[model samples]
Target: MAANEKIKEKISHLPHKPGIYKFFDENGIIYVGKAVDIRKRVSSYFNRSAQHNKKTLKLISQIQDIEFTIVDTEADAFLLENNLIKQYQPKYNILLKDGKTYPYICIVNERFPRIISTRNKINDGSRYFGPYASVTTMNVVLDLIRTLYPIRTCTYNLSPENVDAGKFKVCLEYHIGNCKGPCENLIDETTYNQNITQIRSILSGNLSVAKNYFKERMAAAAEEYQFEVAHQYKQKLDLLDDFQAKSTVVSNTLSNIDVFTITSNDKCSFINYLKVMNGSIILTQSLEVQKKLDETDEELLATVIVQLRHEFESTSREVITNIELQLPLDNVTVTYPQIGDKRKLLNLSLKNAMYLRKEREGRQEKNKDLSEQREIRVLETLKKDLRLTELPRQIECFDNSNFQGDNPVASMVCFKNGKPSKKDYRHFNIKTVVGPNDFESMYEIVTRRYKRLLEEKQPLPQLVIIDGGKGQLSFAVKALKDLDLWGKIAIVGIAKRLEEIFYPGDTLPLYIDKKSESLKLIQRLRNEAHRFAITFHRSKRDAGTLKTELTEVKGIGLSTAESLLAKFRSVKKLRELSQDELAQEIGQRKASILYNYFHNVA
Candidate 1:
């Protein structure tokens, strides 16, 4: 009946086959893993005599349940584990952090198809190709396609019925000879379809087919003594040759291969993928995945291989990697080449991955240096401007928020070294103060904030900013004086109307130059505190409204009301929803009640 004994029994019954296993806690699945032998791999976690890292030990302690799926091969196990990790987003799996959707060339499926580039790949019978890595390269291909075949750029329907009915006019694209006016019936459907077929060949990286077609037409024109037609075909051939030359040519004999290489640091791994077609590199992409557990190079490479191949929609039968892997992909050859063009291709991919890693590291280092320098400069300027004894490295700002004396709240925003220290920020509901008494609310929050910090033996801020004129500032000063912190820590009040800074006992307020960095920094702190307070106030008011309105429905609770508010955004929108639409969100019974409530029906 014990948890450990149950886990042991479950492990003992695990099949000795390749599969993916999931470790679950009471809440949900926490980890997913792949194994060649499920029983052995699952048992390794329970080995009492072996030393486990803190994370591994923690993962073991939370294993309330285990579930697995048997697969036919290790590759299948790897793929299934990846899918499960993506679906559940388990805490202990390596996360692929790349969220970009590459551009694809879509040939619109219509009577007269138009080839264009798009980032969205919706399936409506349109054929899409090349989730291209470089927009410049994709544009080049698009230009070539347009130059070779004069397809329409306009978005007219161009149906046979529309053309026969004379419901369309020839656009400027037709006038400029860029489009063969299918809308005006100047180009037949069969001829346009034939041009699209050749374009498909070019986009698929089978340039030779398109070249041969042009060559045959040129020869036929020359034989017919049509010099002008032959010249045009010759020009098309020249354009194709120029485009091929611009591509990264590997070897004439090599075609339809995928190359992958990986480089990694302690925290993350980077993988580069190169898609080769017709002996040229057609696409190159780099991926970065954050490491959770201590995974080996082989494991990381395998995961990236599956992801990149699927993302690029690669159909190459041969896959080349920098290291040997037991992928066991059906009808696919996995190779690690040491000396040949394949090796060169793999080296190029590795260079790309390493370059990306170095660029990221360099950018991070530069940003850190710039941030430190800027922080020191701003803090030093502020200290000098305010005539403070110290640099005021830890500054806190307070602002009060209320709507006509309702749901009153205050916010305290902290800044360390001129940057927002969001973790140290606090929000206080005006517990002791009643009505729109800003001075009393300020006094209460200031007293409560530092009193708790002092009792807890936490460090106090170097500077405190009160977001009001002398009235609120005087109350905050009184609270600090009672706590014996007024002289030890510097405090000031900023007036919103004229940007006047008031000292504790000083009569006249100090006004730094309007363009001074020190004044700007103080403005930033004041604005941030006010923004935070306003956000808290709005949420509290919304909650109160939800309780008073939606929660009064016959069967609706707080959670249901919150859900309805989140879905419809406002009660007014909910009132506009039809009964069927409301039923789709909630059940019919609740929807009927809500509909009747909104409609004022008895």
Candidate 2:
């Protein structure tokens, strides 16, 4: 490396002003910092009096350029620093780069203001509240508002043409007392304004006011001798109290700090920021571009703190979530309090952040569990029943449904870990069978399914389950053998009575696993397929039945039956026609013939 001369020149002209600083490498990746005096902060590396860590020394050596932004005050510097860190998540900084945007509840300032979720907060004639952790939480709060208040939640775009239009008609919500029906102008401005005021009061950490309002309503109802109405009010008041108790934690300095967490399988990061003013979270956003490849949880936490302290101007003694780290706090103090109310608040914020992360993760795991559950739960039971060495990782279930053998359809619902794998779901329409021939339908469906699987060069399942007993199981095995996949995939049949499971060629079923969740899982999959196929078959059969009925009419031969169906829509409508009218509309002779055929026949 070149001598330390180049680093000195960049630090020399640094101004002694309160602002944020950025250090850039040759590749233009930045490491940002904020200080009260830029000159002193930037010159700290050159100070013979100060000692820096090995990582800091390494970072100083890589700096190719230095840049700074001047701000009005330390607070301004602090806020700006956080904004820049979030924008340019440089190396040597703690980055919480979950691409999740904050959700705000936007109550528009309009004639009929609408409550909506937005990621952006602008002065566009609306009141915005919250950088709520998730849209789910915002929605929950919104649902509460809708439940308690009768304020209109409709979009306020009523035009002159629609002034009297029925589009503003009162919905069932008005009758059920969920809304004041502002769309229909049922409630006046003063009452609507009062409701909005109540919403604001409830949101601003004043839960007691809402509770008091409910209590007053309860008292009024009790005085009127309406016990049922009084009970409802009391219940609502109790719920409000519960909500307040859960969220109302007192913090040190009365500052609100939100901790954000982002975790992948092997990596976890926490970002902590304070919201000093009303509903604005400090540094609530971040971007992580160049993250650690093999970073331990502790290292990640340390990196976050060093970078966060460097980038954020506010050094208020606010403890970040989970991760403990040393920070510089001469002008302002940074802390992670371990005791009293501050600790409670810190822990609550951390828990909420972790819970938000988990809820997001749980949704993805749900999809995977659908298939994997089968292997763990279903196959475990199967192994115990069959005394197998290993559990079945791949399971294939086949079902057939039809209406009198018309438009017959078969479905295959696959499970990898005792859970449904929608990606592996396959559907087959019965082409060979006619008039309720389930065995033939099964054979065709199984043969066709396996043929496609082979053509696509896909692996056969470890276990195959047919929705019927020995006959259906044998049919599946035959298909497998024909396709040379028989010995590869295990075959079994799930019998209908008590829903017992049986292997191919077995006369008896193993229904003794009655109380097993795995058995219930298999039964559910098989039943789902049966239900799906039957629905399709019934739809096709019904259409055929109606057409068959229409075809019997003399004037309504195949084309006329099709036309009448195309025109009148249903057989029930055809039943409503008078003989004379039918004769006049169609040909006189043909109509008379049709009228006699339909009305007089049966």
Superposed by TM-score, candidate 1 places the C-alpha of residue 350 at a distance from the truth, in angstroms, of 1.9
lDDT of 1 by residue, 1-602 (tens): 67888898899889999999999998999999999999889888888525777777888999998998999998788888878877888898876644778899999999899999999999899999989988988898998999999998888888778899999989889888898889989999999998999999889888988899999999999999999999999999999998888775567678999998888887778889889988777898887777777677788888777777777888899998887777756778899999988888889899999999999888989999999998899889999999999988899999999999899999999998898999999999999988999999999999999999999999899999999999999999999999999798999999999999999889999999999999999999999999999999998898678667988887987888888877666777888899998898888999999999989889
Local distance difference test values of all predictions, in order: 0.89, 0.67
Q: Against the true structure, what is each candidate's TM-score?
A: 0.64, 0.45
- Candidate number of the best TM-score: 1
Model 2 C-alpha lDDT versus the unseen true structure? 0.67
Q: What is residue 528's positional error in candidate 2, in angstroms? A: 49
- CA deviation > 4 Å runs, candidate 1: 1-13, 46-62, 97-103, 109-112, 118-126, 134-136, 153-170, 183-185, 188-190, 219-228, 382-602
lDDT score, candidate 1: 0.89
**Runs with alpha carbons beyond 4 Å of true place in candidate 2:** 1-6, 12-20, 35-61, 68-77, 156-167, 248-339, 347-602
Model 2: ten consecutive residues of lowest lDDT: 274-283
